[model samples]
Target: MHRQSVAARARQALQSKPRASQHRKTRGRVALSNNHRAFRHELHYITRGGGRPVILVHGIAASHSEWGHLIPDLAACGYHVYAPDLPGHGNSPKPGDAQYYQVESLLVQLETWIESLNLQEPPLLIGHSLGGYLGLAYARDHSGEVRGLVLINPLYSPRQLSPVLNLMRKRPQLGEKALRATPKWVIQALVHLDPSAATQFSPQIRQQIAADYKRASPNIVYLTQSLPDMTASLPLVKAPTLVIWGEKDLSLNPASFPELVKLLPNAAGCPIAGCGHQPHLCKHQEVNRLVLEFMNSAAVAR
Candidate 1:
């Protein structure tokens, strides 16, 4: 009876929600104008489809193009997917100040965007790499607003990835250059080296990613060069979580998986076979399957 009642409530909620197309047109205009004014150091985001709202956040030095393959798939599966290029990345305005690049700033912008869009319930927060960490932080900070969380190969700690880079970040000049010079080819080589993630996007898409990165701000790059320790931020997340790791990720030590799993109290663990850092790009079908199953279970259980 309780399950049926919850389903009935969800159905009613869906029925009462505004039409997707109308919301998209209104919200898109608002977001575009906000970006033009360089308001709040916010990022640029694209929304596609309608149904359940799903926000896609990308990892360090990455644009929403990271979710390229999965966006259309998710939309086809009846989700309203919103993917953002965090400030300093893609088309978003990147202020030179490091303070605006902090995780807290991103969270604030996310909250603002959600409110501006007039989304009543918190959307399912899906983040990749650093994005996953942000999702964790956002859920922790705004427990009442989120539906659930999905993290894909997210960074768990600052000390683990590359201590040398972490140390280098202390020197502002070198760090600035490092961030500014981080080319898409270099990033592509680092994560999508394996066969699966390598060829998923066409040359045109690759060119676009390169263009976005070329135009990204050094401040955005510098701040993301070293992953923040999101471990402290984990305890606040109360929603059901899903953590997906690529079996062959060379970026963050795959060994950290067990440690991260234990930290997420409400999380389910899944391994993407034959994939690396960007599983959503490499293993879309498998990822979609896992996500759909997880979401359906959550809805039914509610």
Candidate 2:
């Protein structure tokens, strides 16, 4: 009953927004595949360009569209990029079951997505925030299958939460209800609290984000609830890795960057000055250069 009400409200809110046709067209095409047997749903992804494969994963409450700036840049540089909306976000089908939002479930879906594509070699994996956490987990379990990894402002553990979020973490049912009932403006305000996040997007991308949040709010809540300690997997990842962090990231503990670098035997760190959590979007040019450099170096090492 409550879920239905929330869905109804979201649909109403979505109806009030400008149609997708009003915005600039997306560069990538939406492709669907049913390669993952564990989940009985087709995976939706945006794939563009053709060359060395690069799989881009987005963070919580975001879709593949989050890579709007970096996708074309990567494709222009001779890399075939695949950015999936994950399971419960973007154009992908969202299941009502909370189990679908678990970190382990997302990792399995990623592995299956790769297998379905049947790449000649392990493609490079680049993830931001929760996506970064998922990428690390995938690299650790299937070390040889990944060419390299790039983590941009990755979240390894629970972020320092506010009183409301802390309460939400403790009482997930209440959190879900609250998130479902919250207005889009409220959510957007919270997201844009970090000035960098607000300045990173153009007006078009901002609209897309607002829509994504409306649909993926429940998934976001669940993901926050399932935040796990990623420290255990850090030592096990054998893939060449690059950890890029925003110098002024207010979301995750900045101190974790050095500690994360210390854990990975074959990893390097680069901090973007005067940036926040969404460095890939705001500081994309610098981020792209670092990504290209790291990928090129990894290829030479091989």
Q: How many steric overlaps are in each model, in order?
A: 0, 0
lDDT of candidate 1 over 73-169, digit per residue (tens): 7899888998888877776676766645555445545555665666755689888877887788767766667888888988767654645545655
Q: TM-scores of the models, in the given order?
A: 0.77, 0.82
lDDT of 1: 0.67
Worst lDDT run of 10 residues, candidate 1, spans: 1-10
Alpha-carbon deviation at 291 in model 1, angstroms: 1.4
- Candidate 1 local lDDT, residue 234: 71
lDDT of candidate 1 at residue 80, scale 0 to 100: 90
Best by lDDT: 2
On the 0 to 100 scale, the lDDT of residue 22 in model 2 is: 16
lDDT of 1 at 168: 54
The count of backbone overlaps in candidate 1 is 0
